[model samples]
Target: MLKFVKHNLETIAGVEIYPIISLSIFFTAFVLFTVWAMTYSKETLNTVSNLPLNDDESLTEKHNF
Candidate 1:
């Protein structure tokens, strides 16, 4: 099954560039996200990190159906 797929891909023109383009896109996004995370605010990070454990009454009131 792998051999059949490889043979079919080899027959297609310009198919090789698809992998390079996809890899470039993934690498660019990964680097940008890494930079953003490195520079993110520490105070905001603390607030967001505690969101799940927060039990404020207003939050519960807003979400009540």
Candidate 2:
């Protein structure tokens, strides 16, 4: 089954570039996210990290409208 798929893809004109393009896209996104995460504020991180443990009332109070 794998051999059959590989043979079909090999017959295509631009099939080889697909993997390279996909890998580059994934790599770029990973790098951008890493940089963003590294520079993100500690206070915001704390708030987000504790979100699941926070009560609904607390959330409303903290972000009062």
Candidate 3:
């Protein structure tokens, strides 16, 4: 089955560029996210980190299901 798919793909023109384009997009997004995370403010990070543990009534009311 794998061999059949590989043979079909090998017969197509311009098929090889798809993998290169996908890899480039993934690499670019990963780099951007890493940079953003590294530069994120510590104060904002602390507030976000504590959100789950916070017992504020307003949050629970606003998000009530």
Best-fitting candidate, measured by lDDT? Answer: 3
lDDT ranking of the models: 3, 2, 1
lDDT of 2 by residue, 1-65 (tens): 99999899989997889899999999999999999999999987887777778776776577552
Per-residue alpha-carbon lDDT of candidate 1 for residues 23-42, written as tens digits (9 for 90 to 100): 99999999999999999999
**Each candidate's clash count:** 0, 0, 0
lDDT of 2 at 62: 76
Ranking of predictions according to TM-score: 3, 1, 2
lDDT of each: 0.85, 0.86, 0.87
TM-score against native, each model: 0.80, 0.78, 0.81
Candidate 2 stretches greater than 4 Å from native: 56-65
Off by over 4 Å in 3: 57-65
Pairs that collide in candidate 3 are none
In TM-score terms, candidate 3 sits at 0.81
Alpha carbon RMSD to native, model 3: 3.6
For candidate 3, the 10 contiguous residues with the lowest summed lDDT are 56-65
Deviating ranges (above 4 Å) for candidate 1:
57-65
